[model samples]
Target: MKATPITLLVCALGGEGGGVLTEWLVEAARLAGFPAQATSIPGVAQRTGATTYYIELFPVLQSQLCGRQPVFSLSPVPGALDALVSSELLETARQIGNGMTSPERTRVLTSSARLLTTQERMQMSDGRRDPAELLKLVRAFSREHQVFDMNAVARECGTVVSAVLLGAIAGSGLFPIERRFYEEAVRGGVPHEKANASAQASLRGFAKAFEIVSQRQTQADFVSQVLKAQAMDSRLRGNDAGADGNDGRATALSVIPAEAGIHGFPPPVREFASLGYVRLADYQGRSYADLYTRRLRQVLDAETAADPQAANGHAITRETARWLALWMAFDDIVRVADLKSRASRHDRVLREVKAGEDDLVKVFDHFKPGVPEFAALLPSSLAQKLVAWDRRRIAAGKEPWAMPLKIGTHTAAGMLALRTLAAMKALRPRGSRFAFEQKMIERWLDGVVQGTKRGWALGHEVAHCGRLIKGYGATNERGKDNLLHVLDHLAVLPETEAATHAIAEARAAALADDAGQALDATLVRHGAPKREPKPQPIRFMRRPVPRESMDERRA
Candidate 1:
């Protein structure tokens, strides 16, 4: 039988136990009496940004033939790898880009998308591809490809997904090692009983799945033998040529062209010039090569400028931009700084944005005027409370503002407007408040109408105004029982409902504190929900039977 090297490319995130998986494969090969090497490139968030482990194993004649050296370089030839295993979908896609697998020879086992790069989650132009869609594409490329929700399976097995994924790969039957080698490898450093059980489960699961593809080895062996024969024949031909006579070698030599008839240059130079080459010295330091390089650069630049995906160097589309923008807007409205920080926290997000993570739409939403306008009308006491709340958020790795809370920016302007409106409302008489409200609304409407032409919208502008009004009204009545609870639910209501709730909360608080019964007259005029009577606690009594006992004893 001809010997064939089995190469396995194990792809995963940096912290996803890729090293443990590599170790398991190495130990399994050793136990099976195969020569094996395992090498890894630890991802550093710069190049590819995902850890990749490579393993190669071949049958060895004896234990003495095995060496300690690890295979650190990738195989150069195509159709050489036997298996590709990935802990994440994007990592598998990366291996495809590197030409590590072919439809005929390689088997792929990958987990569906459980771990997503920050870019995939928030910044990619085309947005994240569905894990199922990616798996379908891989399956189309190779019939041996398989995908599973390893994360779900891990949860079911009460272990991590990485181990589950590795188990599945081992179960594929591409390797020569028994399941015990993999089990023992996983058991290292873990409690003996638990490790043994987990390893056993992994081995069983892999063995069950491995039987499906075991029949293809006959074809692989045939191909291996053909390649070995060709290699041997080539070596024999080289030896035969080396043993030939001088005359036999001399007859193979070709004539060189004379310079005199070749434009005062060597025949090779003349031929190259005719084909398009130019002599830099004769051409005044300019040549076709220089011109070609410049033109190539220009084409690249133009292509990058025209194609947004090219500019980003990955698939990012206009639809993705719109989705990210909306998500940013949602984060702003909800005051969810954690989501914003996490949205672009990784290199993937930076790569997808091209301009850096800070430039991503989700991160950009915080800096917009609409977000801070609502933030500004919040009472100083409430603002202080929120600031404390935000400090905790920042400590928990959140970005507190949709944008930085610096003064003199558009965000500040919105805040100033909301504060001004709040002050105006507080100073106006209850009866004349509508006139003030109409004036403030006109000012807000004017800003919206002007900003809309500049690509801003009424939804963002009105949300800002509504948030300010609601926060101000809620903070003022926080001492009232059930008022904050009602306001909490009210804040998430439809815009119209929010407005109604804001007006109703303000009216109730005003009536409860009114000294001249003016609020009663106002409530009668406005038709608000009437306050219910407070419930009184019930009292209980006990019987006095002990006094009768004392009287009987005296008798």
Candidate 2:
């Protein structure tokens, strides 16, 4: 009779040493006198690509003496894999999606860490795929899966993640191999390292993963206890209390320093709201922060009355606090200049571009100024003049004026330009742009207050609409249109009906697509007319007038 070969497929980022891990496993098997083979398919780094290593081990004695050989696959075949080890949470899910994992057969070991994808880091709005959703799929697909911060363990061990992964496989008891096989593989098989330290990292990773699996025997009760402990710890640190600061309706929230003008709210909510205050204050000034406070208080009042637990807790108010801050701190030309001129920004550019302390780095920011950016910096009547000038330029088939600034953050003139715009924060509210943003925010908050009066779920949906109002210029305006669509079309439910379902659906649809196509579809389903995309301004280049066909021109 033939013996079955054990197969393992490992997925890792490029530098994470997935190939080294595969070599360790094959060496472990060979040292045990078993016939083993390892192969890998390497890819570019990050979300662009992943490296996968496959290992197959056959029976020891039979392969040596009985002339029995096993044929193993060079690449993983979906549903046939016995084990999968991934260095990232999303990569683990990616293999599962490719059908490499089966609930009946595969055991998964993966890191519960995320390195955001390019799509998630987009500037216009929140482009992140939900981590919770990825986790849910991980738990559902694998027969058994273990997750932990393997990268931290690797760092602590003074070795790479490859050593730890080898240890995890060794400790898993998936094979009858001793821990020494992994140790021997690291010390003897791997070159260019102190054998002791490499083996130790491998041992620690193995032990840790094994301990986690052992705990999973009582996983449900264990998870419940951990969650409760975390909740308790949070309460002790950031206590969530009622508006009266008596009833514990919430846990302590992250607090900001007192000097950041993060006043007008209790410390718990103040800390949560401070980032927005700093942002808007820097974008405009302290009075703009005052406007933020007044709008936030409106939400708090509505929340205090409608929140079932508010008499004993402040969760809703705190949740709404950050969004109020963000909405009020809308982006504009002034913000861009202020950020670009910061010393920290200059330092970051140097560090990222890898310029040595003595090395000089030059940065030029490209800007195309149309009516809006220029007009916003001018007073009302003068702004109208700039707008008229831009209209004439576009009408004359000329492009908007542009400026390329070599970053002079360290120089007086360069610093002055950014500082001047930063100082312009004081005049922001008087500008046409700030007024438009503030008006949109006011109208949105009105819906949220009304939603809270309706129900908690509805309020939450309304609060979530904050996700749509982000970025600047056209991106900001599109999000506002989507918010209005839901507020006007989808959320006009009768007081008795549950508006939460429709509103939540609309919010999800708005976030699902950049162009708001999904949002349009959702609205159309709810009886909205098809929305026309606003026409873009004409550019300088024309279609060459089609060479003025002589016969057609004569006709």
Candidate 3:
């Protein structure tokens, strides 16, 4: 309805230069002898902020009318938007979902790469959002749209992404301004040669987007063909015929890794085995990696014998592949030391902090290791003695003791200390905590094996319960308790409800809350009793008698 003012709505994550991009557009419009205004609402970094910038430009042919001026709104009118530029695929769809863009009017410019929302990444299971859904909405909303990997374009030019977005706006050609105005806006204060590289990347992004728009119809047809092919492939592979989703046995068997020593097994088994081997190898050493392979081999043998036809695509091995690898490479003090001491970790830290070539960087690691962490390294008898001492201290109105270590990992001696501790991975199996975790893993694996003999669905549920036993220290202990409780309590239920849905419901409940309240509610729903609250205790503190004054002692 407001034809005189061209409106653009930009939706971007924090630090992708949304405000800078808006500034560039405003400058370009003004440079071309047009009246323009831009404003932005600040947003939080990553996924959770309200960062939207709005711009309105009114074309003025001449400066003849001194008294006349144009009015522009600070925010975009939802259905009247002329352009929508988004840094992410989902955000593009989100704006459209909000009815900000009309199919008949707006041109959509978006990057297809995903940084994934925090919510998507934090799920207890595979939490990635599907890209396919966004692609469909991209087509439905924009009258003329261009989608490409803008991040790659920016990287190629060795510059930030604001220039690339500016280039995209110029290429859209909705405005009558020459490209040089946009280029001048960038290269004004900077040198021509240095600025041209940025200008070129911006222009390249613009041209790429324009081409996509021109050939969009053909692109849509190709997408349709790809979709049909995928559907046919899924049918042939029997991906959707069962409850395991697109992860069918045949498909899993078809994507075997080319890694050595796993060729004897089928594709699915080889895939997971290779991953477990690599993970454990990195977490510990070649010997431990071999141990993981041997365990996987046992599961593979059982799976092959029990389900020779490979129903559920050797789902048992698939589940073991994930949980077993995670369980075997449990986090510990030794593992922390190993990670921190690695040269690769040092290099990564340097890169993250963006240290200069001549800058001297010092890194200090702070650790407050209490009795438990210390006990993991000592012999059982020594560990018990140390724990008893801490208990005695606590009983005498003192806090449980901890040795706070300010490890200067930046210094030669500090780095060496950590590296020595890292080298103790060979002695890890003898540690009390390691032995305890290994026993727990063995029990979980046994449950999986038993579930498989009873039913694949039940086995799958049990294997998935490995998600319950995660994290280090207290969290790990709580997860272990939940897993064992479920196994013990649910084993009594009939195979039908317990295996098919109740187990999954219980697992969901466990993940729903950190305090185990949701898990208790779920357990109660499934005929298990609610957990009783622990009894509270109060103790009186006795202060030490003050020493008598010198004068009083003399008297």
TM-scores of all candidate predictions against the true structure: 0.38, 0.64, 0.75
Query: What lDDT score goes with residue 39 in model 1?
Result: 80
Where is the poorest 10-residue window by lDDT in model 1? 314-323
Error of 1 at 353 (Å): 29
Best by lDDT: 3
Tell me which of candidates 2 and 3 scores higher on lDDT.
3
Weakest 10 consecutive residues, lDDT, candidate 3?
Answer: 244-253
Q: For candidate 2, list the clashing residue pairs, or say none.
A: 167-206, 238-252, 239-252, 240-250, 240-251, 249-313
lDDT tens digits, residue span 134-215, model 2: 8888788888878887776765555567776776677566666776676777677555255565465566665665566446
lDDT of 1 by residue, 1-555 (tens): 336567787877865677877777777666667777788877877325777788878654336455544333454254567788887777787777677778887888877755656665453122466766666667755537767666556544445556776667666666766766666666664654665655655544444434433434455567679867866885977664335453332355545433222233223233322222232111212332343223223322333344434333311111111222222122122233223333244343444343422453332333343323343435445545665676566566655545444332124454454344434422222222223333443443333233223222222222233222222233322223233222333323445444344545543544344331433344334443334434433434456669889899899
- Report the lDDT tens digits of candidate 3 across residue range 1-555: 334888888887877777777777877777888778888877766587538999887766437437587888988888789999888888788788889998899988888877778888676555777788888888888787888887766655445566667767776676677877876676664655776554555555545544544366467668879878877887988876444554433444355565554556667667677887888888877888877777777767767766889977988887787889888998878889999988988887776554657878999999777888877767677778988888777777677788889999999999999989889887787777777777898888887777766776777788789888777777787788888878877744775456547678888888767688888988888887666554333456777555676558778
RMSD per model, one decimal: 27.4, 9.5, 8.1
Our tally of clashes for model 1 stands at: 9
Query: Candidate 2: lDDT of 529?
Result: 60
Candidate 2 deviant stretches above 4 angstroms: 1-5, 13-17, 20-34, 41-49, 58-82, 97-106, 115-128, 140-144, 149-293, 307-319, 337-371, 406-432, 450-461, 481-555
